[model samples]
Target: MNDKVGIVIVSHSPDVAKGAADMVRQMVGNEVPLAFTGGDPGGGLGTSVETILAAIDRAWSEKGVAILVDLGGAETNSEMAIEMLPEDRQGRVVVCNAPIVEGAVMAATEAWGGATLDEVRRTAEELSPA
Candidate 1:
């Protein structure tokens, strides 16, 4: 089977992250690799670089990985997570600046369609809340 790009969702609320993941799964079925990290390590309203790193690892694919963050520190933590990856692999990951829910859906669908990492990221970025 051809390896497809994977998706990671980051959010300040665990429920938001998980809910968005579920929606993406419904949209893409089992064909896409999907993972999510939300809330703090202590189960509070925040994000952790470690958790984001683990989620990225879970969604890792040779094709590449795209990450969508909800808000606030999620973007920062996601960037840190990507930076934590080895230099060789860091370029394989992208943190998208799209709304988490919409971006996750678009990214997962693009991945399910076997799009390249850059393709998936572009698809997600094309989505506008306006």
Candidate 2:
């Protein structure tokens, strides 16, 4: 994998997550690893820990992964996903406290510039809170 940090978009609605991931990919290209997930197991509007975990896996990078979530529930599920990862991998994934769509784009842009995990996270967080 590339040295750039990865990006994961999480939202309660599948369409929102997919749209945000699409925007990031359009702007950042394939320079950074990217993945996204949303909705509960039944495909309703709710976050899923399992889906978040899968997104993390798809976007895995040795550098780290930054997850941008749409709401508090998404943040909570993202936390659970991070906790479920191996001890060595847990800290490498973080749930960013920023708007999902804007934050994902910003974080991905920074990651494309070869920023570290913390740098990408800070870039996302610096935006107005979601």
Q: In TM-score terms, which candidate is top?
A: 2
The estimated TM-scores of all candidates read 0.95, 0.96
Residues 1-130 of candidate 1: C-alpha lDDT, one tens digit per residue: 4399989999999999999999998877978888998999887999999989999888889898999998879998889888999988899999887989999999888898889999999999999654
Cα lDDT tens digits for candidate 2, 1-130 = 5699999999999999999999998987977999989888886899998888999999999999999998889999899999999999998999888888889999999999999999999999999754
* Each prediction's number of clashing residue pairs: 0, 0
Global lDDT of model 1:
0.90
Cα lDDT computed for each candidate against the true fold: 0.90, 0.92
Please report how far candidate 2 places residue 46 from its true position, in Å: 0.6
Which ranges of candidate 2 are over 4 A from the true structure? none
- Tell me how far the alpha carbon of residue 21 in candidate 2 is from the true structure, in angstroms, after superposition: 0.4
**What is the C-alpha RMSD, rounded to one decimal, of candidate 1?**
1.3
Clashing pairs in 2: none
